[model samples]
Target: MTSNGTSIPVTADGIPRPGGAGSLAGRTVSRIGYGAMQLERLRTDRAAAVALVRRAVELGVDHFDTAQFYGDGFVNEVLREALAATRDAVVVTKVGATPDPGGPLPLRLAQRPEELRASVEDNLRSLGTDRLAVVNLRRADTGPGLRAEGDQVVGLDDQLAVLTALRDQGSIGAIGLSSVTADGLRRALPAGIVCVQNSYSLVSRDDEDLLRLCTDEGIAWVPYFPLGGAFPGMPKVSDEPAVHAAAREIGGTPAQVGLAWLLHHAPNVLLIPGTADAGHLADNLAAGGLAPDGEGLAALDAVPSRSADDVRLG
Candidate 1:
C-alpha cells in the first residue's frame, strides 16, 4: 500500500519486494535506500546524475540520503531536479559543514546553532522544497570527517533546540544525527530523532553499542560507509577474508554480503549505499535479497573489528 492506503503495484516497491520493507522518518521505506554522496562524481554530467536518481525511484528507492555540502550543493541540486517529478520520497539531508571545493577535505565545520539553520535553508533552496523531509545534524564530536574548532563548538541541546523549533514551525519534518557518539545521541533523544547516520560496517563494530541503543529505542540506524573503506586505515569489508567466505557461501558479491550482514544484524538498520554508476546501484538494491545463512552469519560475526577503524566509525 502507498502512504495514502492505495494498493501499489509490484513495480512500486521493486527492490524492496514487500518482504524487505523497513521504517524511517515514521514512514515505510524500502529496506535498501540510495545514498547520494557518490553523485558528486557525476557533477559534470548533470543529466546522467539526474537520470540515476530517477532510475533509483523507478527501482523503488523511497528513502534518499543527501547532504547540502555534497559537491558543495551540486549533489543536492541534482536531487532537486531528479525528485521534482516524483512524490512521497523520504529525502533526508545532513548539515554541520559547508563545502570547500578547493580544500584538501572539501568541507569545513558549520556546526553552530545558526550555521545549522543556514545549511537547512540552503538545502531547502537547493531542493526547492518548503520543508525538508529530515535534517541530520552532523556533529564533529566523532571522527571519519572534520572536527569542530573553537567557536564552531556548540552544545548538543542548543543544536536540538533549533532543529526542534524548525520542526514545530514546519521548516523540516524530523531530526537526525550523523558522525555522532552514543552519549551525544542519548542527550538528544528527547528531541525526537527518527534516525542515526554513524559510520558502521561488518568490519567496523565499534558502534555496536550505539546500534543496539537505536534498535532498543526503535530509532532507525542509517549507517554511512556501510562497506567501510571511507578513509585510510579504516578496515574495509572488501578486505576481510571472512566476508569473502561469507559472500561465496551466500552467492553474492563481497560488497553485497557485507550489506546483507547489516540488514541481518539489526531490524532497525536501513542501508543507503550510494553509487554513481547504474550497475553498482542495482547491486546495492539487490543486496536486500542476499540473506546470509547461519554459517555465513557466524563467519561474518566472528570477524573482529579493527581498532584502527575505531579511529572513525563512531
Candidate 2:
C-alpha cells in the first residue's frame, strides 16, 4: 500500500498521500510532506543537512516548506538540490521578511509591491525553480512570544492584494500566512487564503482556535513547531509520554508518533517536521502509517499544553 517506497500509504490518488487540503498548493502536495527549515548550516552542518533533504525524498516526502529568511537562502538551495529530479514534490517558500546576511539576526520587512515581486523572483532563482508552488507572506514583529498581537504595521489588505496579483500572474500557485494571529487570518482569508503556518505543537497549542478556523474554512493548518519550539534545548521527542507510549505500542519511534498524532488529530492539519539527519528523515516518513486511534488519540490529547514559547521567530 505504500507509494514511492516511503512509509506513507498511498491514497486513491496517484500522489504519495493526502493531508488536509485547505488550499490549492496544499491540496496539490502529498500528505506527510517534509519541512526543510532546519536543513541549513546556520543551525547544523551543511553536509548533514543536505543529506537529510535527499533522504526525505527517498522516503516519499513530496511537500517541502521553506522561507527566504531561513539561513537567508541556504535552506531553499538545499531543497532545490534535494528534490530537483523528483517528479511530484512541491516546494512552499515565504516572502515579506528578509534577514540580514549573518547570525542571530532580526528580520526586516521587505514587502512593498515591487519588493514583493522581486522577492518571488529571487526565491525562484535561488531555489532554481520556474515558479513557486506556495508563497507565504511572513510578518516580522518586534515581540517576545511566538504569536504576538502587535500593532498592524504592514496592512493586511495591502499584502493580500499583492499576493492575489502574483497568483494571477502565475508567479506562485497559492498564498499563505505565517506567524499571524486569528484576527490577522480573519482579515486575510477573503483573498483566497490556502494555508496558515502558525507555531503549533504538542507543547504550544495557543493557536488551537486558529486551527479550528482553518478546519471550518477548509484551509490547511500547517503547524511549524510540530515537535517543539525550534531550539537546541527543546524537549526531546521521547519526553511526551503520549508519543513514547504510542511508539512503544506501534513499534515505531517517538518522533513518528508525534507526527502521527498531528495527522490523526485533524484531517486539516499538516505537519512539517524538520531535521538534519538522513536516518531521521526516513524514520519521520515512516510515522505516517502508524495509525493511532481511540486511546492513542486520547492520550495525545491529554498531553499538557504549554503557552506560546518566548521565541519570536517561528
Candidate 3:
C-alpha cells in the first residue's frame, strides 16, 4: 500500500490481526501504535526503558509517537539506544513545545516557525536519524494542555511552511498537526497532512467534527487521550457505565471495550495509548483485537458524550 496497487506486508506477532491495518501518511501501520511520552518515567533505569521499547517492537508495534521535549529528550534518548540497530518502524515526533522542567508546567509553547524547525532538528539529533518518518506540529490554540500566548500565537500556515520545506528536502517523511481546530485543519489540508493527534475518547468527544473531517480527508485520526487524559473535570472512558456493561457482555475489560469502540467507530481512527508499565502496554496492544457483540456495541453507542466544560466527577 505504498501508493501502488501492490500490498504491503505487516509483521505478524501472533497477536489478533483484526482491526490492525491502517494508513499513516501513505505508509501502512498498525491501527494500534505506542506513544513514547510515558518513557520519561523510566529514565532512571535506561536499560529497563529500552527493554520495554524493544518488547513493544516484538509485540508488533510499528508506529512510535514521541517528542524531543518529552523528558527533555530522555524518551528519544532511550529510543535511540533501543532502536539504534533497527529502522523497521516509523518514528513520528512532534514540535511547538520545549521542556520546562523548572516551570509549573512540564512544557512551554514554541509555536513559531523557527522554533518548529529547531525542534525538528532536536528530534533528528536525539533519535540519531538524519530524517524522520513524520513530524506533527503541536499547536497550542486549543488544548487539553497549554495555549499559545502573544508571540506564540503564530499562524498555522507560517508553522507549516517550515515543515513543508523540511519534507521537501527529505528531512522528514510526512507532516501532521496536533491539537488543531477544524478551521486550522482546513488551512493545513493543502500542506498534505498524514495524521492528526487530538484529545478524544468515549466520554470527551468535543472533536467529533474534527475527527469526521479527518475521516473525509483520509488523514489518520490518532487520538492522544484516547482513554481520556485524566485532566480535571474530564471523564475517562473506563468510568462510563456503558463501557463497563459492554465489557461484561463482551467479556473484555472496560478499557479494552472503550478502545474497541474507537476502532469500530471509524476505519480512519488510529490509537497511540501510552504506558510505562509492561502489563499495561500488553493490554493496550490487545485492545485492537477485542470483538464486541451487538448488544455491547449498542450500549457503548448509547453512552452520552460530553464536552470538557460539561463533565465533572459526579
State which candidate has the highest lDDT.
1
Ten-residue segment with the worst summed lDDT in candidate 1?
Answer: 1-10
Candidate 3, which segments miss by more than 4 Å at Cα? 1-9, 12-18, 309-314
lDDT of 3 at 164: 94
lDDT of residue 36 for candidate 3? 92
Each model's number of backbone clashes?
Answer: 0, 1, 0
Task: Compute each candidate's TM-score over C-alphas.
Answer: 0.92, 0.82, 0.92
Candidate 2: residue 187 lDDT (0-100): 85
- Poorest stretch of ten by lDDT in candidate 2: 142-151
The sequence of per-residue lDDT tens digits that candidate 2 reaches over residues 218-291 is: 88878776877455444444677667777778777777777777777777877777776666766776666666
lDDT of 3 by residue, 161-278 (tens): 9999999999999999998889999989999999998888888788889999999999999988788746777777888888877777656688887788898788999888889999
Candidate-wise lDDT, in order: 0.83, 0.70, 0.82
CA displacement after TM-score superposition, residue 238 of candidate 2 (Å): 4.2
What would the per-residue lDDT of candidate 1 be over residues 69-133, giving only the tens digit for each residue?
A: 89988998999999887767889998888987666577888878899889989999988899998
Native-to-model Cα distance after best TM-score fit, residue 177 in candidate 2, in Å: 0.7
The full ranking of all candidates by lDDT, starting with the best, is 1, 3, 2
CA deviation > 4 Å runs, candidate 2: 1-26, 42-51, 101-114, 140-152, 231-238
